[model samples]
Target: MSRWRTALVTGASSGIGREIARQAAARGVDVVAVARREDELRTLAREVRDTWGRTVEVLPADLLTAGGLAAVEARLADPDRPVDLLVNNAGFGSLGWFHELPIDREDRQIRLNVLAVTRLASAALAAMVPRGRGGVLNVSSVSGFQPMPTNAVYGASKAFVTSLSQALHEEVRGAGVHVTALCPGFTRTEFQAVAGSDVRSLPPWVWMTSAAVARAGLDAVTRNRAVCVPGAGYRAVATVVDLAPRDVVRRLTALATRASLPAPEAGR
Candidate 1:
């Protein structure tokens, strides 16, 4: 059983975030599911309630705006509705050369992927530390461990998440709070479609389900583990990237990423 009682999950409408919410509710935790899609969030809340018999409150807001982000911060900062688990799972990527893609698009990606993660994590920790119990899970990617040529900005954002999560994990270990970065490789999600990449082009062996990734993240954070790359293959790959020659890793990553990856579709 998880020590957490209530959780606030960004991007809880679908994919890995939704899975995490379900898993948390299964362990008897109340959930506040945040996402831009109001309908999807409502549906998920209903499913969680019906399936796990746990309460799920849906909050629809875009983290890109100051108002939307502020509302979430206030909720986390509120002592009355204290959230013991925080999952920063809301993020998207653009697949293209850094210079070729619209600079504004990359900036939005950073704002949501990096800035939002930083601010929300801060809010969660500020409250969690005082209470002396809580956990923060930041959903990152395997690309954080290596350079991704086609998706440079997205990779950079994940790197920030991975680095920050590891540092924060150590910083708050004695404070009775856990911070974990969940670095998952390719999974069966709408992420690829939205990013304008075809999932079928990638090797089947590299794919894992969102449910599997969510389970790994929840387990790791509960155990106070700092970093978790879910799949066996990806774990081995991450280990090699950390130990291997930087030049070799760079060349290999660029080559692999470029082969299966296409530039993001126009206006995507």
Candidate 2:
């Protein structure tokens, strides 16, 4: 991995983030795990140390908050313990109607998913580009490829990540910095529960493991692929969507989103 031995993974307490951190450690990369759960982060650190004998720093901070975001940004720009790779993976979604969801929840989603990714990526690149080697893998989603009516905020946030990552990939290529966006479809993660969606209700084949997605992302980073949609099904879907007409895509997406969304409770 060379100088890409150290990586900082956000949302590292569970699901895709946890698996990504584990995979990085398995590859001999030291990891810094960031999340709001102090206990979870500490446990992950211990697991990494015992299982892979790798260094793991536990950063217990909610990236949606200004203090937490600024603290992480400062760490990224730190000269003494420079981070070689950045995985901007912390994010959440609400499955209810956009109008029905709390304003603060929606706002926090944008803060963590979009704002934090932008700031951290910029911080990492500022350090990496000058010295000429590092990588940033933003964990986007397949929802980013098209408009999703029910998952509007979540999909839009991921679109921002995908677009930002691709542009940054080109911008930093000359400086030997790798930037990639991993746009995975439904993966087995806490994201489903938190988002108020049930993947078990969907087809089994539609879901991939967190490990698989994270592994594909790291591979893309190492190979310098700007975008990667893991799993064959997702790849094919993305390809078809890429070639499909805009109006058709929008109609199909709206129908699918409406169908997939769970119905609201009775007296609410």
Candidate 3:
């Protein structure tokens, strides 16, 4: 197994982020796990240390905050010792009518999903470019390929991620910095729980394991693939969505969004 040496992963407390950290550690990569939940981050750090016997450092920061993002930026800019890999996976979705959603929640989603991703990717590149060897894997979604009615903001953020990943890959090709965007479809993760959606209600085929998705994503990064949509089923769906008429796709997505919305509380 090739060691990553030093790797930093945002949103490392759980789900795909957690799986990425564990897999990297298992292969002898020293991991810095970043997330808002200190307790969960610490717990996962311990698990990595015990399970993989690799060094695991936890950095608890809400990437949406200026102070937190600044702190992360400082860590990534350290030239004396640079990280060899970066995994941008800190993001979430709001499953509801767009107008009914709270303004602050919408802002948080964009801040963590888009702004933080762009900033961190830049910082990682600043360090990696000088050293001339590293990888950046941005975790996007199949939603990025189409209009998502209920997950509108989230989907837009991921589309930004995918676009940025492709652009960066071309720009940094000769500089030894490989960039990849991982477009996954409904992986088994705490993402739905955080988004307040019932994952179990979705069809079994729609759910992929976080480990499996992470493996595919990391492989793409190592191989320097510009974009990766892991499963055959997901790739097929993405192809159809890519080719479908825009207006028709939007209407169907809006109907599905309506079905996913929660009923108003009894007192309200």
Candidate 4:
């Protein structure tokens, strides 16, 4: 049985977020599914309700907007409803040279990945700390383990998430509130398509399914683990990244990223 009575999961329209909602419901937790797409959220709500007989509330909101963020924050702070879990899973990435990429998109990425995650976490913790029984699972990425040359902004944002989660975990553990960072490696999801990350060259062994990632994250938070790196391969990679010297890791990451990209045209 799940420790949580109710969970609010963002980015619930698809991928890991969607799987987390389904799996949490299966584990007997009621869910509030949030996403920009109402149709998708409603569809997930129906599926979860039909499959597990759990209450699934569909909340449609874009976290980037002030009105959307306010709506979700208000829901998190609602004492009557009282969300027992907060899953900060709504994020996206852009793969390219930082200088060449659109500045507005990068700013938006920070707002969604960093600003929104921080705001929602604050709202949830404000309520949960007083109650002394709740959890927060922030969905981060393995790329945060090191400096990603091509995907700089995304990496930095996830690094912030991991750091913030660990700090929050230490702060609220005594209060019986769990805070965990779910750092997943490459997973088969719409994330790659949305981010324009071509992972066709990456081996199948490096990838994990969304369901497995979701299961590991939910289990980690339930057990009050501070950090959960889903796959063995990713865990190993994260360890190496952690141990390596900063400069060496940065140089190697740049080289690896360059090697993965197509060569520039012979003539500019």
Candidate 5:
């Protein structure tokens, strides 16, 4: 029998997800890190094993495919694999106005960010409910609070995550299973590169480190917080949005998005 608690973190190959896995392992938790990159996942597993002397399992799955989700389901259902923590953090971003973006990419983004989180949450909760103790961390974003002109679909998907986490937190309140929505703003990660965020365009003060974000999320789960806003700056922004008029928030976010990730150049 594994003595350490078992945590399953999706998108564990990099960014906030990878940091979460490392943090959990350091705290004496065995981890099952899932990602599409098999090589990176294996490397992370080895590193975690070496540093923490904890059991590390690498399960490479796309999370955007039915086959990938099925693999996750199988592992969750396996009697021997009892997940004490579940981190739903696999997602990506595509920049541009919604109409101008490729429809296929938008479809993939929705499938990965929204559908995958819902399916994985169901699987994790199904097992955890029976055991009467567990934690689920949904990686949402500040973008979820308002319309994002450059990342509309991505924002919508994160909104779904935030909503789902809150509902689940209430539903399982007394069941010993806590659910937390980790709403992080700009974290220093490959996400900006993928989203094509122009460094010169945004304020430098908005960014948070991956390790700090991971720590805040883990702490939230342990304390059973329904929503975990990692950075003070982000929390303040969220507060402002909540207090401001809806239209005002909408316009501001739209303008910010437009400025951050501009459309591709006209000619190659």
Candidate 6:
């Protein structure tokens, strides 16, 4: 059984967010599913209700907008309908040289990944700290562990998430609230297509299923772990990155990332 009675999961229309919602419901927790895609959210709601007999609330809202953010924040803060868990999983990324990517998109990425997560977490903690019970699971990425040359903004955003989660974990541990950062590496999700990341060159073993990542994250948060790196290979990479000198890690990451990209098309 889940420690939470109700969970509010962002980015719930697909991928890791969708899996988290399904798994949480299966574990006996009601869910509030948030995403920009209403149709997909409704579909997931039907599936969850049918399979697990759990109440699934489909909340279609773009986190990038103020109104959407307010709606979700209000739900988390509702005294009568309290949320026992907050899954900050709604985010996206872009893969390209920092200068080449559209500035507007990068700004939106930071807003969703960093600003939205921060706002939601703050709202959840405000409620949970008073009640002395609850959990916040922030979905981050292994890219945050090192300098991602082609994926700089996304990496920085996740680093903020991981840092914030760890700090909050210590802050609320005594108050009975658990805060955890779920840092996943290369996972099989719509993320690749959306980010324009061509991972065809990577070995099969490097990718993880969304189900496995979701399961690991849920279990870790329930156990009050400050950080959870889902796969053993990723854990090894994170460990090495942590111990390695900053310059060495940055140089190696740049080289590896550049090698993965196709050569630039004929110059303008």
Worst 10 residues of 2 by lDDT: 259-268
| Span of 10 residues, lowest total lDDT, candidate 4 | 259-268
Candidate 3 local Cα displacement, residue 240, angstroms = 1.9
- Model 1 Cα lDDT, one tens digit per residue, 99-191: 688899899999999999999999999999999999999999998997789889999999999999999999997999999999999888889
CA lDDT of 124 in candidate 5?
A: 88
TM-score, structure 3 vs. true:
0.93
Which residue pairs clash within candidate 4? none
Pick the winner on lDDT between candidates 3 and 4: 4
Better of 2 and 4 by lDDT: 4
The residue ranges of model 6 lying beyond 4 angstroms of the native Cα positions read 263-268
TM-score of 4: 0.97
Question: What is the full ranking by lDDT, best candidate first?
Answer: 6, 4, 1, 2, 3, 5
Local distance difference test scores for all models: 0.92, 0.90, 0.88, 0.94, 0.88, 0.95
Better of 3 and 4 by TM-score: 4
- Against the true structure, candidate 1 reaches a TM-score of 0.96
Error of 5 at 176 (Å): 0.6
lDDT of each residue in 1-268, candidate 2, tens digit only: 4347899999999999999999999999999889999899899889999999999998888897889999899889998998989999999887767777788888988988899999999999999998788999999999899987888899899999999999999998778899999999988889988988866678789889998998998999989999999999899999999999989999998877778766655544
lDDT winner, 1 or 4: 4
Task: Give per-residue lDDT, candidate 4, residue 79.
Answer: 98
Pairs in steric clash, model 1? none
How far off is residue 233 in model 5, in Å? 1.0
- Please tell me which model should have the higher TM-score, number 5 or number 6: 6
- Deviating ranges (above 4 Å) for candidate 4: 263-268
Q: Which stretches of candidate 1 lie over 4 Å from their true place?
A: 261-268
Cα lDDT of model 3 overall?
A: 0.88
Considering TM-score, which of the candidate structures 2 and 5 is the better prediction for this target? 2
Question: What is the TM-score of candidate 6?
Answer: 0.97
